[model samples]
Target: MSQPSVYPSVSPGDPSWWFSDALRAEGGEKPSPSLSGQITVDVAIVGGGFTGLWTALALRERAPQLSIALIEASLCGSGASGKNGGKVHGYWASLAGMAANIGADGALAVARAGTRAQDAIRAFATVPGRDVWWRESGNVRVSAAPAQDAKIQLYVETAKRLGVPDTAQALTPEQVADYCRSPVFRGGLYLPEGANVHPARLARALRKAAIEAGVGIYENTPMTGLTPGSPNRIATAAGEIIAREVVLATNIELAKRPEVSRHVSVFSSYALMTAPAPEKLAAIGWNRDQGLADLRMFVHYFRKTVDGRILMGSGSGPISFAGNTKNPALTTDRASAARAEKGLRRLLPGFADVPVEKVWGGGIDVSSDRLPFFRTVAGTRIHYGAGYSGHGVNPTYMGGQCLASLVLGVKDEWSTLPLCTRDVPKLPPEPFRAVGGRLVRWGIIGCEEAEERGVQAGVMMRGAAAIPKVFGLRIGTR
Candidate 1:
């Protein structure tokens, strides 16, 4: 008889097969002891995930003498950092959208910063003793439908116009099939700068590196209250911390604050990992390790693991009601996992018989403009950055560099990128936000379905897709 699935339903990203088992191996980093008494530091960073960890490392690199303390609600890599699809690529694909929001010059600056960030990750991944399973095998943004193909064509034109010709190149159907056998793929855009890695391993490696660099890390320590004083104070469950500066790298948790929450919405995304299918993958000619994402509004991102299993994710999962990121419902949903698995099967028929090894879900903080922004919170000593729209793997590194610059009060190039702005666009409030979100979601699905059927979307569907654009928002599978 077939053995029962261990994770029959979706659960928090924490106990996923990827992070849990690997973390238990001999010599895997253990959670740092939590803070228990009053203490002070030069910099106090909340959130031990990618953003905070990167910030700690960046600070040490720039100012080796500065004392830094990083507090986490759980162990490092327990959140999205460990649970993500492990895609670390630049933001060149969003150049047109960035240019529309910030002028072309500003957009170019952001793109350059993104490129630098990608390179930084590449360097870190290859360094000795990291063991992060980093692979710079590039990525492919493919099209399986007529509408998606149309958008891919526009993206290629924009990349060329933006002088990023070497960043992305068009791929013929035959060429795309050579990389990954998918009959639905009409064409693809290949980016050689993209990379994939073992996310949990990277996070753990960052933790080890940060500690070795003399940064104090306290896990299982949650920051509960913030008191604005001459020097800001952070209250934790069993201790208090006074700091010269604070960096709030808590990505999804930013929704709890009105100033930042209004501009962000929390949504859940699901993924399914298949049992090792080395023979099947070879049979399908999917020998390349490049990460792949389809051109649907709600993206279908898939990549092969170092162990040869395919990990597939779907972005069209549940959204929080009333723009609340703290909604417990955002944690997990089995239906979402099923949908993601179905998408994976549709893309690769060769995996039809492969048993799913596990299923998981996690929250993502999406901005109204579908781009990340960073700046000091108004009238406060805190610096913050979030809103990756489900594409944060590499951007978080850029965010860390920007946060480090702000904490040091340095007015250099990293601090002036388009993302380092004070004006973060806000979404509509409650009822309207909820209703409008449904319409947009339904519209995206409708348009994608029409395209799959080789037909144009109807008036309603078109209107729904245009709603966010009408409000000057960018939404697509990037």
Candidate 2:
């Protein structure tokens, strides 16, 4: 994932080359000005990603009189929030962990909340002028190997045992082929609660919604420093925001802070997009627009855009050096891009000839538990949440509610959810962290490669794949 320099997202000759261009162009708000002079607010939120935006929206809905200011170093949604695959759904995969960590009742509550988050997004899209490629077509996690098939079956059983039955169901090979004609797909679990979105557009919609909800937003405003106090002061390039409280919902950008960085490890995820090919799509029976993902530790996720282009992304990319959150070189990994395209060709051979329109990558902050957690930073008024791993779209919404409940100091179910505490296990420190991540990632790649070849992974490779789970941080346990 390391590169010589950061790739410019857009160039004079390559406008609209990326899939997110349309959404950015159609975004409702122009960039807000950078913070200037001194400003005081009830709450100052750092990071304009979904977690920040949703927290702001939730705060406003809960208490309209509370003054809120949201500041972003770059444009809102420019980070993982904007760069993600836009699969929104409940965290059915985390039910096992939740039940183990919390009580069964608590786990059920969290699961229900996760499902409600999906409905909330659908409702948000109904707002006039906020259509964000809203598609409630659901998501399917297909298994191409026996191990994956077993995993999906376990997930179905877990879902039912957790009292969220019918949230996910196993699809037979014939049923899977009906929706997508992929030779690799033996079976899958279909979650009707899922939906796909145009992520950038969704972020834009949130920005617009925040503004309409009376939120003060400042773009190009990075929090350079923070001083803990009754009304903590956040220093930026142009000014400082003194707020009664602050919410750090910056996702992988959380690694910018050494303390936060230690608890999370960052890795790059790459995606590739193809030109719209309606004829080719029809030739393969990909008429359904459900989001698809393989069952692997380092998984591949794909879906169709409204324009009919195929978007393929793989999580098997490079791990960042310790505390290197903003390394530009990781933005575009050509090698990972090639692998994603290769995966797309394997899944949909009929569309192999389609021209690739764009390729991009973004960072993921992984916690030792591979789950999102919220907590109040020690000796500060700062509340933070990170470690969404790669399955964040819905969980972040849940994160927003949890953060809002904590900020308002209300004792409710959200505040009681296991994710609301600072109990998430931490990753190992520097050298070991880096070395271990590489080994685990290598093993994941080897195991998946063997699976693709229809051969069992070697004992050493399986052991590598088990390293993360050994620490209870299953890469794609869901």
Candidate 3:
């Protein structure tokens, strides 16, 4: 088979509305030259999304003497980095999941790294004259249904038991309404460290920073093959790259390799953006400008843009068959898009009539454990990282930190992170992976939909939800 594509198949006529808008704001981005003939560099990074760009920047910061080249099948930030919901927060809200996946100490370590990363982004974003549309209001997770309320309780209880009570606190129904009133919501959890940003603009800033720092970027260059050895060789259609060290930060594209495929699979996430409605937003009292979501297996994450538009996203899209990550219809199906719009109308009905200005979707590399893992290829000087799942905006920073340490061969805090050595559970191979994923997905949809309707899902749907338990895997791999 041909090498997997770095970008999924309309992801964005020019990436996405975020990307196109960012480009329009940029007064037209200067094009980067694609590779031609042959070239050699000290370090070669693949996949020009946030992970790859951050790695290049980190390498430049650590070793300015090293010559670095970043290759992109499309453009930097044109992948998930540009297509995301723009929630720029850390893992305080995910404390329970982290503790469950790794140990408490490990969980604390990753959360703290996330904090540092968030701070780093804030620093970069606040630099005078930069326009990433960053807002530091924080995040909220509302329990839209009574069954969903349990998740809010768990997030708070776990944080308190871990002696970080302030990291995540339980909120009353009134408190949740204070942020964004909705009859469906019961209670919620609040994380003060959360923030939001124009994801594509951040991606653009990184691209500009990388170029200014002397990192050669090859856009529209897809690697067709790789030869792993002392001097790794990466071949593209028109040129090839030879480098002493290599980094595969190519998101779901890495899933093409069995080692990664067994641990990570692709699932589509869709987002719907409403036309600017500052008045509609005010009517709902959603003035806090925080990232908001409902507690569900396939969560609905929503946030406001600088232009007064609300972007609502659903993580409940279908699983790719046989690990085929390419999203033919921009990674969306009619059902998923409908669910996203349903989330917007059901949760924040104030904007129910707001015209949807844009719709975009893309595949996310979800790990078996729902957390990312970083590792070096066995007996090779190459590093790879993926499985961001749906909560990558903040963790990709941690990814860059960890991957950078590995490339430098430095045994420091970042290099020794539990994520670097964790043995995440492996998902089933092909046919079963995709087939089972779809079943569980339907199960989750059935259960959540029933809960929302104030009823119990049928036995069959509930049993499907329990299938992951039988296989000793985390629920909702889809």
Candidate 4:
């Protein structure tokens, strides 16, 4: 008998409403068979989420003769890919951070690449039978608090300074009301390159497409052991895969690797989905397919579904200590879920009475600098990509491009892109990282809450919020 797969210990409420609804709409889809016995192939991709699935599809497109097999711990989409709030956009919103890390030219290259990846996503989402609910009405970042207005200014000014004035538009109070009449929204910035999707549906569609392309995928087949060499050996509960190359697209699992662990940490984010309230959304003039978020360090990101429901998410969930991937604070933190519900009441007050049908939470692999990176392991064919922070919906597509080029030994633009070799700042290690991270989280929450309430934060809180910048890091505050 095969040993049981070891799944992540998330909340009972997870796999989320997204996955549940996507499964119903999947139309006679049967679970993929788990791997059995020993096998060898050209490549063995681990994770089976967006990155792995996209890599498989990319590999097939680039080299039809190359054999590929992917293994997943749970269902293909059951990871963070399925458990997110489904906001999609490119790197223009992050131009300031990118430019600050890389140069202006480097930032532009990555942002343009993100746009191409986003275009691909839009095209894939709208194929004849692929009903991924691709809504492309753009995104809004509202200034719910007086202090938060600066972030909106920063995004707009950064884009303009980079000669991409069309990337973002600063909105006046009256202009903001045109999107939605939220009392909390003083003003906002509009970015044209934004969209939303039924996340699980999109992931499932990708899984289907990969299978159609003849990429072997095994669900509920977690890799139990991985020994890297020229021919990488991937041991699993039921079988083993020997492949010439391997792609470690396993999200937060990458945090356990010494090389990766130094540069990344896991932070939880929770979301609340309200029942179908199309009329209430219309009453608030939020009927468009726009995704909206507040300009807080830990933002309140919310959006509407094609079926007229609303999703309100809070990125203020707890952080895990080093190598403690199973922290319940990431998956079952009641305080974080409550904050999301509270945000829905505050931001979209028109839907204050709407019933929240579900509450789900998951972890985000946050980099020292909050951007994703891709590269190969030293002296091995094992390539990896991660640290997408919280804004991964579109970057994962770019990651697929980078990982694919790395595996093919091709030095094209996708492979040579700055993202592949950018020097990501290293995070503080061990006791200091965990202990100081908690203090910073407390400060961020306290500061943002005080600002929302039109008050001043304590000196200690403000100091804590400013601590990361002292060390050339980007967390604790925007």
- In order, candidate lDDTs are 0.82, 0.79, 0.85, 0.88
Candidate No. with top lDDT? 4
Candidate 3's C-alpha runs over 4 A off are 1-14, 327-330, 475-478
TM-scores of the models, in the order given? 0.94, 0.92, 0.96, 0.96
Q: How far is candidate 1 from the true structure (C-alpha RMSD, Å)?
A: 2.6
How are the candidates ranked when ordered by lDDT, highest leading? Answer: 4, 3, 1, 2
Highest TM-score against the true fold, candidate: 4
Cα lDDT of candidate 2 equals 0.79
Clashing pairs in 3: 12-15
1-478 in candidate 1: lDDT tens per residue?
2233333666544466667745975266567899999999999999998899999999999999899999999888888888889988877877777777776787778878888999898898899867787877899988988667877777778788888787778998998998988778889888887889888888887888899999999999999899976699999999999998999988788877777778887777887788898998998888877899998878889999877799999887778776566565566666677768877777887888788888888888888777888888777779898888898889999989999999999998788877886366778888777678778877877787677779988999888877886876654323
How far residue 335's Cα lies from its native spot in candidate 3, in Å, is 1.0
For model 4, how does the per-residue alpha-carbon lDDT over 177-222 read when each residue is reduced to its tens digit? 9999988889899999999999999999999999999999999899
Give per-residue CA lDDT, model 3, range 336-436, as digits (tens): 87788888888887776677877788888999888888999999989999899988878888898889999999998888887788888888877988899
Best of the two (2, 3) by TM-score: 3
Show pairs that collide, candidate 4: none
Q: What is the Å distance of residue 350 in model 1 from its true position?
A: 0.5
All-Cα superposition RMSD per candidate: 2.6, 3.9, 5.0, 5.3
